[model samples]
Target: MRVLLTGGAGYIGSHTAVNLISDGNKVLLYDNLSNSDASVINGIAAITGVKPTLIKGDVLDEIGLVNAIEKFKPDAVIHFAGLKSVKESSLKPLEYYSTNVGGIVTLLRAMLKTGVNNVVFSSSATVYDSRQKMPVDENGIVGNAANPYGETKIICEKILADIWRRYSLNVTILRYFNPIGAHPSAMIGENPVYPNNLAPYITEVALGKREYLGVFGNDYPTVDGTGVRDYIHVCDLAEGHSLALKNMDGLKVYNLGTGKGSSVLEVLRAFCNVEERDIPYRIMPRREGDVAELVACCDKAKKELGFAPVYNLTDMARSCLAYARKNFSGKIK
Candidate 1:
C-alpha cells in the first residue's frame, strides 16, 4: 500500500513509518517539523533502508496538503499532525483547538478534493471520561475529557464520525494509551522537544539533566497511591496502525494498549532496575485532570485487528534508558 503520514517525523509517526516501510509499503511523509526534528528522516532511513518521500508542510495548509496528495496519490493516510501536550493545552486552549481541530478540517477538505477517502486517525485514550469504568472499552462514553488536549481528541472523533456518515469515508480511530519505550535498534524513540509525559521526564532524571522526578500525587486511589496507566510500547502501537489500515472499511474504533496497569512508582522502579541507578523523586500535589487509573480493555482490538502488546514494563524501561543514553552520547541523531 502507498500511504502518506502527516506529522510523520514526530515520535510515534517516525516509528510507524519504519513499521510501514518494513512491511513493504511505500510511505510519503508530510510534516512542518514544529515539534519534531528534520534529522529524524535519516534515522528512519538508517533503520528501514528506504527514505520516505517528505513534504515539509503543515496540516492546516490546505493548498499544500492538496498538492501533496495529488502528487503522491496515496491509497490511504495516517493523520498524526497536531499539538499534543495536555498541560500546554490548558495554557493555550485556542492554539490546541485551532491546530488540532482546524487541521483536520483542512486535511479532510484536501482529501475530498483529491479523492483520497481512507484514513487512520491517531486518537488518544484521554477521550474517555475519568469516572468511566476501569479498562475502558470502545463503547465507553466520550465528551467528558479531562483537559483541553483530550477535548480536542473527542471533537476530532465526532467530526470523523460525522464525515463518515455524510461522505462514506473509510476511517479507523486508534485510541492509544500511554506509549513509552523506543525501537529496539535505538534508532528512533520518544524525543519530545519539551518533555511532559512521565517516561521522558523519568529518562531526563536518569541522564542527570533533571534534578529529581516529581511523583505527582501519592494520595490517589491506586496500588501505590500514584496514578496508574497502561504503558504500551511504541513499536506495538505502531504495528497496530498498520493492522488498522489493512482491515479498515468504514468508521471503526479500537484501543491500542496493554490490558494491565502500572503505577508511577512501579515504572520508576523498573527504570532503576534496568539502568542500575536510583532515581530520586518527591511526591507532589496531583495535577488537575488526572485520573486514579486509566487502562484499556483491548479485547476488541485483539479479536478484530489481531493486536496484542509484545513488550512489558521491564522492556519499556530498558529501551527508554538505552535511547536516552545513545541520544545524550551523540550515538543517535
Candidate 2:
C-alpha cells in the first residue's frame, strides 16, 4: 500500500512511516515542518534505507494536497498535522482553530477532489473527559474538554463521522493518550518544537536542561497524590497506525494507550530508576486544563484492530532517555 501521511515528518507519523516502509509500503510525507525538522527525513532514510517522498507545504493549501494525491495516489492518508499544545491552544484559540480545524477541511476537500476515500486520523484522549474513570474507553461520556486543543479533536471526530455517514468514507480515528518514549534504534523519536509534554520535561530535568520537574497537583486523589496518565510507547502507537490502515471500511475509533495510569511522581521516580539519578522537583499547582487521572481501555482496539501495546515502562524510559541523553544537553538550546 502507498500512504500519504500529513504531518509525516512529525514524531508519530515519521515512526509510522518507518513501520509502513518496513512492511513493503510506499510512503509520501506531507509536512510544513512547523514543529518537526527536515533532518528527520534523512534520519528515516538512514534507518529504513528508503526515503519517503516529502512535500513541504501546509495542509491548509489545497493545491499542494491535490497535487500530492494525484501524484502519489495513496491507498490511504494518515493525518498527524495540526497544533497540539494544550496550553498554547488556550492562549491563542484562533491560531489553533485555523491550523487544526481549518487544516482538516483542506485535506478533506483535496481528498474529495482526488477521489481518495480512506483516512486514518490522529485523534486525542482529551475527547473523553473522564473525571471519575480510571481507564477511559470509547463508550464513555466525551465531555467537552477544558481547552481549545482538545475541543478541536472532538470537532474533527464529529466531522469525520459525518463524512463517513454521508459519503461512505473509510475513516479510522485513533485517540492517543500520552505518547512517550523513542524508537528502539534511537534513530528517530519525539522531537517537540516546544516544551509541553511530560516525558520531554522529565528528559530535560534529567539532562539538567532545567532545574527541576514540576510535580503538578501533588494533592490529587491518586496513591501518590499527583496527576496520573497513560503513557504509551511511540513504537506501539506507530504499530497501531499500521493496524488501523489494514481495515478500510466504515468508521472506527480506537484508544492508543498503556491502560495503566502513572502519576507525575511515579514518572519522576521511574526516570530516577532508569537514569540512576535523582531529579529535583517541586509540587506545583495543576494547570488550568489539566486533569487528575486518565488511562485507556484498549480492548476494543485489541479485539477489532488487532492492536496491543507491547512496550513496558522500562522500555519507554530507556528509549526516551537514550534520545534525550544524545540530543538534548543543558548547553544546546
Candidate 3:
C-alpha cells in the first residue's frame, strides 16, 4: 500500500511512517516543519531501512495538497498535521482553529478533487467530555471540549463523518489518549520546541534542562490529587494506525489507549525509579480547561481492530529517559 502521511515528520506521524514502512508499505510524508524537525526523516529511514519520500507542504495548502496527492497517488492518507497543545490552544485560539480545523477542510477538498476516499485521522481523547466517567469509549459524550485544540478535533470528526455519509469516503478516526515513550531505538521521539505535555516536561527535568517538573493542579479528585491520564506508548499507538488502515470499511472511530489510568505523581515516581535520580517537582494550581481523569475504554478497538497496547508505565518512563539522554544534549533543530 502507498500511504501519504500529513505532518509525517512529527512525533506520532514519524513513528507511524516507520511502522508502515516496516510492514512492507510505501509512505510519502507531507509536512511544513512548523514544529517538527526535518531530521526525523533520517531517523525513520535508519529505523526502517527505507527512506520514505518527504513532500515539504502544508495541509491547509490546497494546491500543494492536491499536487502531492496527484503525484503520489496514495492508497490512503493518514492525517496528523495540526497544532496539538491544549494549553497553547487557549492562548492562540485563531491559530489553533485555522490550522487544526481549516487544515482538515482543505485536505478534504483536495482529496475529493483527487478522487481519494480513504483517510485515517489522528484525533484525541480530549474530544470526550470532562464530566463523563472514567474509561471513555467511542460512544462517550463528545463536543464538550475543554479547549480549542479539543474543539478542532470534534469539528474535524464531524466533518469526516459527513464526508463519509455524503461521498462514501472511508474514514477512520483514532482518538488517542496521552501518548508517551519514544521508540525503543530512541531514534525518533517527541521533541517539541515548547514542551506542552507532561511526559516531555518530565523528560526535560530529568535531563537537567528544566529545574523542576510542574505538577499541574495537585487538587484534582484523584489518587495523588493530580491529573490522571491513560498514557499509551507512541509505538503502540502507531501500530493502531496500521491496524486502522486495514479495517477502513466506511466510518469508524477507535480510542487508542492502554485502557488504564496513571496519576501524575505515579508517573513521576516511575520516571525517577527508571532514571535512578530524584526529579524534583512543584505542585502548582490547576490551569483552566484541565480535566481530573481521562482514560479509555478500548474494548471496541481490541475486539474490532486487534489493538493491544503492550507497554507499561515503567517502559514508558525508561524509553522517554533514553531518548532524552540521547537527544537533549544539544538543540533538536
Candidate 4:
C-alpha cells in the first residue's frame, strides 16, 4: 500500500510512517515543515532503513496536494496536519479554524478531483463532553469541545461523515487521547516548540532546559487535584493508525488510548523515577478550557481493530527520557 501523510515529518506522523513502512507499505510525506523539523525524515530512514519521499507542501494548497496525489498515487491518506495547541487555540481561534477546518476541505476536494477516496483523520478525545462518564467510548456524545482546537476537530469529523454519506468515501476518525513517549530507538519523538503538553515540559525540566515543572489545577475532582488523562505511548498510537488503515470501511470512529487515566502528578512521579532524580515543581492554577478527566473506553477498538497498548506509564517515561537525552541538545527547531 502506498500511503500519504500530511505533517508526516511531525512527531506522531513520523512515528506512524515508521510503523507503516515496517509493515511493508510505501509512504510519501507531505508537510510544510511549520512545526516539525526536516531532520525527522532522516530519523525515519535511520529507523526503517527506507527513506520516504517528502513533498514540502501545505494541506491547504489544493493544487499542490492534487499534484502530489497524482504523482505518488497513494492508496490512502492520513491527515495529520494543523495547529494543535489548546491554549494557543483559545488565543488564535481564527487561525485554528482556517487551517484545521479549511485544510480538510481542500484535501477532500483534491481527492474528489483525483478519484482518491480513503483517508484517516487524526481527531482528539477532547471532542467528548468532559462532564460525561469516565472511560468515554465511540458512542459518547461529541461536539462539546472545550477549546477552538477541539472545535475544529469536531467540525472536521462532521465534514468527513457528511462526505461519507454523500460520496461513499472510506474514512476512519481516530480520537486520540494524551499521546506521550518516544520511539524505542530514540531516533524520533515529540519536540514541540513552546511545549504545550506535559510530557515535553517534564522532559525539559529533566534536561535542565527549564527551571521546574508546573502542576496545573491541583483542585480538580481527580485522585490528585491535577487533571487526569489516558496517556498512551506514541508507538502504540502509531500502531493504531496502521490498524485503522486496514479497516477503513464507511465512516467509523474509534478512541485510541490505554483505557486508564493517570493524574498529572502521577506522570511526574513516573518521570522522576525513570530519570533517577527529583524534578522541581510548583502548583499552578488551571488554564481556561481545561477539563478534569479524559479517559478512553477503548473496548471497541481493542475488540474490532485488535488495538492493544503494551506500554505502561513507566515505559512511556523511560522512552521520553531517552529521546530527550539523545535528540535535544541545545535548541530544537
In model 3, which runs have C-alpha deviations exceeding 4 angstroms?
331-333
CA RMSD (A), model 2:
1.4
| Model 2 CA deviation exceeding 4 Å by range | 329-333
Global Cα RMSD, each model:
1.7, 1.4, 1.4, 1.4
Sorted on lDDT, best first, the list reads: 4, 3, 1, 2
Error of 3 at 204 (Å): 1.2
lDDT of 2 by residue, 1-333 (tens): 989999999989899999999889999999999889888888789889998788998999999999989999988999999999887888999999898889888999999899999999999988887575668788887867878998999999999999899888999999999888898888888887876788888888788777888876777788888888899999999999998999767998899997998888887788899988788998888777777788999999999888888998878888998887766654544
lDDT of 1 by residue, 1-333 (tens): 999999999999999999999999999999998888888888899999998878899999999999999999999999999998887888999999999999989999999999999999999999998798788899988877889999999999999999999999999999999999999998899888877789988988888888899988999888989999999999999999999989979999999999899999999999999988789999999887677889999999999999988999999999999888987765222
Identify the runs in model 1 with alpha carbons over 4 angstroms from their true place.
330-333
Better structure of 1 and 4 per TM-score: 4
Candidate 3 lDDT score at position 102: 96
Q: What is the C-alpha lDDT of each candidate?
A: 0.92, 0.88, 0.93, 0.94
Better of 1 and 2 by TM-score: 1
TM-scores vs. true structure, each candidate: 0.97, 0.97, 0.98, 0.98
